[model samples]
Target: MTAIPNETMAIIAGGGHLPQLVLEGARSMGLRVVGVGFAGETDPSLADSMDAWQWQNLGQLGKLIAFCKKQGVSRIVMAGKIHKARAVDLRPDWRAAKLLWKVKNTQDDVLLRAITGELESEGMSVVSAMDFLPHLRSPEGVLTRRGPTSEEQADIDFGWPMARQIGALDIGQCIVVRKRTTVAVEGLEGTDATILRAGELVGPGCVVIKLFKPIQDARLDLPAVGPKTIQTMIEAKASCLALEAARSLFIHLEESLTLADKAGISIVGLRS
Candidate 1:
């Protein structure tokens, strides 16, 4: 594939290592990257990795749009996690206020959908987070040194449809199963918390399944996992993690797999 064009690519970041990865990916692909990180959430070190970086609170829609325009950014990608709980303190500008009033639902999809449309209306096209970081996309088949046991495989197969259904409804993108029964579904608390909760509820050998919602907008968000996921699984006594291959982001793949191998946790990236 050709390298990313030498265009101005703006990254609107929130929290987690995902934004940092996105910056690195963009730079490697030959793009001039500018970053807009959220206050108190995004890592400040991200600035060192970008051509230019600025911080803002979660509700500064006007500032974000202005920053992009000033940088001559034609393409934008958003990465990292923004805790919805923090919306309680949101201070929206006129532009953001108008968008908020137009949106009927405050659910993740509704909010992001509105934001996407707002950005597009302002002439800033949102690029997929994986646009330059395709390698972070999960690969098919078993990824860890050890494959899942028969029982774990059975759990994965059993939970696959249910997980996808949950995802389709936007209830969550992850489900924890044990003995073919769901233990926990990931919602706002996120994957790590969900896995820990599942372990507590189901005890040992629970299988975790994570997949992109059937109607998920790849340009905006996708379920993500990393090395910390393996640690959480091991702590919870989980035996396996089945992620939707190529649809989910596999952050920190090398360290994640190393930890999984050491913990005897099976990591499988599956299609469907």
Candidate 2:
């Protein structure tokens, strides 16, 4: 969320609201957008908003870069979810294969950093999605009608570092807890699926905690939650949310807070 570019910027889009959000932000700032979306990860309808657009396979790093260079892009903002499990479906071309061969492990941060390095070497800066969607970031404080109850606060205290530990291991960014017992840890199924899985496991009254990984790259991905996340928690009958304040993105803020307030869900923005 620093200074927005006035020249054309690139949206390395994924799915859901990501492309549209960046498009809207870029348009508002008078920056024309050039987009390249991952094949199965991006919405096709978003092609209309791009001054230049293309759909690329997951491992077509060469083609992706070439397309951006062709459109004279200098800055790139990546948004939306790219399921790591999609590695199973990866069809790596020479450039991507070379990059993969140099990596020691396939952890999200490691791979993303490698990709960022690759982009930077080519004179393309990789920026955060939050740069375009700054309003979605939740500030530090209680965000709903109530703060976490003592018992819920206990659960948050208990789960917070555990979430951080898994994050340190680069496992994932979320953990579900109830009365200090771990319910479900996110395993690439995503936060929403993790919440629903926890609800199914323990049934109601669970606390969901999401954090920014200790080793996370601030310029890249920060975990995102939104109105849809609240809707999922409501459906799961989860009681509270303890998200890292000033670190997490709370998209659709008013609607999400309204949903949480109506459902009597305690949403405290946890400061690290």
Candidate 3:
């Protein structure tokens, strides 16, 4: 594969370790990174790692674009999580307001696609986060030491399509199932909360499935799993995790796998 040419890239960072990972990946490839971080959503320590950085409110599209232009950034990558619930309470700037008004619905895909279109219109291309850090993508097959049993495999088979349907509808990317019965479907509350809710309803031995949306834009909101995910599953007593291979991001893979193995949790990457 050809390397991404060394140039200043703008990272529109939100929350979690992903933004930091992307920055390290870019720098390792001899590219300079300028980060635009959301105030409440982004980690504060992210500023220390950037060649240049600016903090903006979730709805400050104008400021974000301006900052990228000033930094001479032509390519952009979005990383991290932006809580959909918090986005509802945004105080949009004029540009953002205009974009919001134009969209028929404020579904995750709709809103992000609009923002991406606006950025592209301004001569900035948004690239997939995986392009900069392909290693983050999970490989096909079982990752943890413990592979799923036949029963747990059945639960994954039952849950994967349902998760994908919800994802395609822009509802969510995660679902919790126990013995082929879905106990919880993720909403704006997110994966951890959904898993906890499932545990409350169905007790232990649930299979958690997270996957990329069938119609998802590769450049935005790819499904991600990490150490925190394994920790949450342990807390909820979820037995198995099924992630879409090549389409999902796995952060802290070694630590996450070690923790999963210790807990006897089975983690498999499916090629769907």
- The candidate maximizing lDDT is 3
Against the hidden reference, what TM-scores do the models get? 0.94, 0.95, 0.96
Ranking by TM-score: 3, 2, 1
Runs in model 2 lying further than 4 Å from the true structure: 1-6
The 0-to-1 C-alpha lDDT of every candidate, in the order given, reads 0.87, 0.87, 0.90
Where is model 1 poorest over a 10-residue stretch in terms of lDDT? Answer: 1-10
Q: Model 2: per-residue lDDT, tens digit, 214-243?
A: 999987668888888999999999999999
RMSD of every candidate to native, in Å, equals 1.7, 1.5, 1.3
Candidate 3 lDDT tens digits, 144-179: 888999999999988888888988899998999998
Residue 47 of candidate 1: its Cα lDDT?
82
Number of the top-ranking candidate, with TM-score as the measure: 3
TM-score of 1: 0.94
Q: For candidate 1, write residues 1-272 as lDDT tens digits.
A: 25447788898887898988888878787889999997788898888878877888777898889888899887889898887668646889988898888988677777888888988888878888888788889999999889989999899989999998998887778899999898998887888889999988879999999998887788877889998888899999999999999988998899999898888999999998
The alpha-carbon deviation from the true structure for residue 108 of candidate 2, after best TM-score superposition, in angstroms, is 0.4
Minimal lDDT window, size 10, model 2: 1-10
